[model samples]
Target: MLWTIIGIIFVLWLLGFLFDIAGNLVHVLLVIALIVFIFQMMAGRRKG
Candidate 1:
């Protein structure tokens, strides 16, 4: 689920790069997604 969100956001970010539509918003979401991905990785590592 988390990965899905990250993937979707990443796709949108790439689309923004090509189309220049809502580029800023997509970039922000991409950053948020990256932060969440990092946090998830950290939590998973601790549990394992």
Candidate 2:
């Protein structure tokens, strides 16, 4: 689920960059998604 969200955010960021619309917002979202993904991974590792 987290990976899916990250993938969607990445795709959106790519599209935004190509179309030059809300590039900054998309970039910020991508960064946020990356952070969330990293946190999720860390938590999963600790759980195991």
Instruction: Give lDDT tens digits, candidate 2, residues 1-48.
Output: 887999899999999999998859999999999899889899999999
TM per candidate comes to 0.94, 0.91
Q: In model 1, where is the ten-residue run with the lowest total lDDT?
A: 21-30
Q: Rate the local accuracy (lDDT) of all candidates.
A: 0.94, 0.91
Best by lDDT: 1
The worst-scoring run of ten residues by lDDT in candidate 2 lies at 1-10
Query: Clashes in model 2: which pairs?
Result: none
Model 1 agreement with the true structure over 1-48: per-residue lDDT tens digits: 998999899999999999998949999999999999999999999999
Give the top-scoring candidate (TM-score): 1
List the RMSD of every prediction in angstroms: 0.6, 0.8
Instruction: Predict model 1's lDDT versus the native.
Output: 0.94
Model 2's lDDT to the true fold? 0.91
